[model samples]
Target: MRILFSGTPAYGHLLPLLPLERAARKAGHTTAFLTHASLGDLVAPAPVLPAGASLEETLDEFHRTTGTNAAEDMSPATAGEFFGGIRVDLGADAALAAAHDFGPDLVVAETADFLGPLAAAHLGVPWASHGVGIALEAPLAEAMWATAAARATARGLALARPFASVDPWPDCLQRDDWKPSRDRITVRPEAHESESGSGSGAGWEAPAFPGREHLPRVLVTLGTIVDDPEALTEIVTSLAGREVNVVVALPPSSADGALPVAGAGVHVTGFVPMRLLLQGMDAVVCSGGAGTVLSVLGAGLPLVIWPLGLDKPLNAERTAALGAAEVVGGAGEAGEAVVRVLEEPSYRAAARKAAADIGAMPRAEDVLPLLTARLG
Candidate 1:
């Protein structure tokens, strides 16, 4: 089978689809990734068919056209316009052309990426929606569908219902009221790693912060998009005074001197893959991106979430409801939350339970037959 995997250009949108793409390849199936050209590196070894503008370009266009910031205004209508309206308006033709060239038998798209489904419908091929983390709230989903439908209508086509929804979130993390509209295929979520291991920080060595070996180690990361040097510095400084050793992961764009001077227990490094960075970490302090949240929980580590915007607030709330994380309002609250998570056994226990639930889900390889069977 020729499987075409598609998603938005950002890490949060693209990384979730890798496990299934890798699984299909492992099962002797041909697979290609379709997304913005810049994100080709994230899905290395799988040939990337360029489609759509870069994420920055799309966000800029959305801002210019709508006169509203997506990050600041995360209401259903605004998010829908950003993801389904502007993104598809800018990229649909490119995505459709790429789909024609690839002629895939199946298209697996990350949730919120409308181009993949649009292309699939145009080609009369089946496509599946792959969940990024928890399922989208109903209002946001309906708004996305409404906008995407309009785009499809303009192209003299109509959106086809997906044959299945590939979900990686375990039941423990899912909302009780929200259910998928199609067949739900459960897949285990793995921390994304490129086949070549080139960009994944595979061999990067963690510095041996000498005397802090005995202290509990915590990772403080705000993900790629939420880079605030001042906030990071404050959080790091707050944690430095505590008993934990802090490993700070900054985005590559952040300069080495961006943060203020720190204690010997604090170590700072540029972006590293979650799989590598989570090693030896007892807890996490983050901005609660879905990828980061799922990765932290999958590692059985508790979290102190400082949600800035977008889907983060919902993710943080759900995670806290599960008792696996503590949601903090600011840098001042972050230190206390981390300390509480470390001292309290309940948080770790809940995280471990979530990990066990994730472990029990079907592996990507195991879901291949189900996807293939849908073609019939």
Candidate 2:
């Protein structure tokens, strides 16, 4: 079967879909990824059909759709508009073109990628949805459907939900209100740690810090899109002066001298493979992005989350409610929070339980049969 995959330009959406894409390819099915033009290089070796939206354009569309300029103010209303805008402005025309040119047997879209469903509706073909974290609520889903309805009408098609929905969130971690109407196949969360190509690396030397192996190690990340370099610098500086060994992973464009105090205890770098870093770390401090939170939980590492905006605050709240993490209001509190997570054994135990729950979930390969069956 020829499969076409679609997602937003961000790594948070694209990375979760890779394990299944690889599984399809290994099973001798041809696959291609359709996303924003900015992420085209990241999908190399696998044929990339550009959606013709740049990262800035996508961000602008998001703000326009959501009716908010600040990421911190994201709400259900914004989510609905975001999905609607994505389908109408970002990926619809490009997806339609890919459907005609690629001739895919099925369309597998990232849950956030509305264009996949629109194009599938246009072509009268079967399509599937993959969820990175939690499922959408009724209001958000309805808002997306509203946009999709208009698109379908314009294309002379009927809007319909996906034939299958792939979710990576474990049952325990899922939102209480999220119950799927479609066939919900749960997959384990796997972290993709590289900037380009198939990110399968697990082997990496721990960041060089002298005699620091004895001290507890804390990993800090703000993700790629969040641009709070000052906050990141403060967090790293606050921790480096403490008893713990600190590793700060910054974005590619982060300034070389971002951190104020650099010593043997703190190591700063641009994009270390997550699987490799998690192997040696004792605790994590992050911006509460679902991808990072899940990765930390999957590794059984207690985390301290600084919720900046968007879905992050909710992710932080849920994880903290589950006892796996402590959410802080700002970066200043992150240093002390990390200390608490390290000293408290209960947090570690909770993390282990979450990891066990994730372990009990299905792998990406387990979904291939269901996907193929749906195609038939």
Candidate 3:
């Protein structure tokens, strides 16, 4: 079977879909990834069909067209305008053209990417929604769908609903009042590592703070999109000052002496895979991006989450409710949160329980048959 995987052009959106994509390829199905060309490197060995504008481009276009700063205003309407309206408007044609060429039996779209479902609808093929994180609020989901439906209607096609949802979020992390919208197929989440072992920091090794071996080690990363050197420096400085060893994961752009807090107790490095970077870390400090939150919890590490924007606030709230993380308002509060998480045993215990629940979910390869069954 030929399967096409699509996602937004960002790590948090794309990486969650990789486990299932890799599973399909391992099962001998022909698979291609559809996203911006800039992310081709992250999904090497699998064919990449470039579609859509980059995140930066789409945001710029949304800002130009709507005269609203997409970054600052993350309301349902504005987010829908950015992700479902402008993104589909700019990339749907390319995505449709590519889908025609690939002729996939199935299209697997990450939750936020509407283009994949649009192409599947045009082609009359079944598509599955692969969730990246916790389920979205009803208003946001409805807004995105309403905007995407407009585009589908304009193209003289009806947007088809997904047959199933491939959810990586474990039962332990789910909200008490929330439920799934469709048939849910639980898949264990794994930290994304490139097939060729050539990712950004593949060969990098964690440094040993020889004298500080007894000190609790914490990782500070803002994920791909939220690159604030000042915030990162403040968090790192705060943690380091508290007799905690800090490791700051710097994006490639900021690797050149951008972070000013690196000192004897603070280590700075480039974008390493979360699987590799989590080694020997006692805890994490992050912006609560889905990828980072899931990876850290999967490793049984507690977190100090200072959400910046987008879905981060929700992710932080959910994880904090699960008792695996602490949500702070700003950088100033992050240090105290991390220290508390380290000193308190409950946080680690909750994280470990979450890890066990996540581990009990079906592996991606095991879910291939379930997805393929929908083809019939």
Predicted structure 1: lDDT: 0.87
Write model 2 residue lDDT over 1-376, tens digit each, in one string: 8888988778788878888887888788999888776665555556788774765676676777555663455455565566666536656777789777888888998876777777778777888988877666666667767766776687787877788888887777667775656588888888765535533333456786778778988998998677667888889866756789988877644656255657888877665557777878899999988888888899999999988777787788889988989999888888888888899999999999999999888877887887777666
Per-model root-mean-square deviation over C-alphas:
1.5, 2.4, 1.5
Winner by TM-score between candidate 2 and candidate 1: 1
What is residue 298's positional error in candidate 1, in angstroms?
0.9
Total clashes for model 3: 0
Error of 3 at 340 (Å): 1.4
The TM-scores, one per candidate, come to 0.96, 0.92, 0.96
Candidate 2 backbone clash number: 0
How would you encode candidate 1's per-residue C-alpha lDDT over 45-70 as one tens digit per residue?
88889888888898789899989888
Which residues of candidate 3, in runs, are more than 4 Å off?
252-257
**Where does model 1 exceed 4 Å of error?**
180-182, 255-258
Q: Candidate 2: misplaced stretches above 4 Å?
A: 61-67, 70-72, 177-182, 193-204, 253-258
